[model samples]
Target: MRTKEAGAAMDSEFHVQCPYCGEELDIYLEPDVQGTLIQDCEVCCNPWKVEVWWDGDERSVAVSRGDGSE
Candidate 1:
């Protein structure tokens, strides 16, 4: 799993790069939630998958193209 860039302002927010267009995105995830969800890049408008989860005490996120490649 990839390490998450936590937003200093909120634990629920994370900074991630859009896999399609390389746009930087700030995404919000609910606490104790773990799953992959489809999200569109705010800048490029291309659809992708956002996988959010936690490993032990560390929050992690992985973005993947719509084709499912990371």
Candidate 2:
């Protein structure tokens, strides 16, 4: 992931596959935002649970069903 300056917010981009739709998607999130959030799949309109975490300088992301189930 790379952080970009988006106006006053620092944005980070990640490529993730939609759990339900199985489509690749580019997701933008403010670097300051942490933890899990719900995002709708652009290709399938299904809700997705997006998890963001950082380990030191490394960034990580996980995606699953919006209902918090595998």
Candidate 3:
């Protein structure tokens, strides 16, 4: 029998932190999204307003923060 794989090859969620409270949070990565992906904090419940710029050629993500409120 073929065993099931626990972790997938590509992770849908990326690790992040809250800009307001500095709390750890997870941001989902859309498969089709090849640009900035804004994210919010779950623990602190704050709007981080993140920006993830991804290079289509290099296939990399550069995360940043925007105007957000706690």
Best by lDDT: 2
How many steric clashes between backbone atoms does each model show?
A: 0, 0, 1
> Which segments of candidate 3 are over 4 A away from where they belong?
1-11, 34-38, 56-70
Cα RMSD, each candidate: 7.5, 5.1, 5.4
Candidate 1's C-alpha lDDT? 0.76
Looking at candidate 3, what is the lDDT of residue 62? 42
Candidate 1: count of backbone clashes, pairs at least 3 residues apart or interchain? 0
What 10-residue stretch in candidate 2 is worst by lDDT?
2-11
Write down the lDDT that model 3 would get.
0.54
lDDT per residue as tens, model 3, 1-70: 4444323216456676666677666667664565554555666554555554545532344444555333
Deviation from native of the Cα of residue 5 in model 3, angstroms: 18
lDDT of 1 by residue, 1-70 (tens): 4345344225677889888887888888776667888878889888778787777776788888876555
Q: Output the better candidate (1/3) by lDDT.
A: 1
Taken over the whole model, the C-alpha lDDT of each candidate is 0.76, 0.81, 0.54
Candidate 1: stretches off by over 4 Å? 1-9, 68-70
TM-score of each: 0.71, 0.77, 0.52
lDDT per residue as tens, model 2, 1-70 = 5454443253378889999968998998876767999989999998998888987764678989997566
TM-score pick, better of 2 and 3: 2
Q: How far is candidate 2 from the true structure (C-alpha RMSD, Å)?
A: 5.1
**Better candidate by lDDT, 1 or 2:** 2
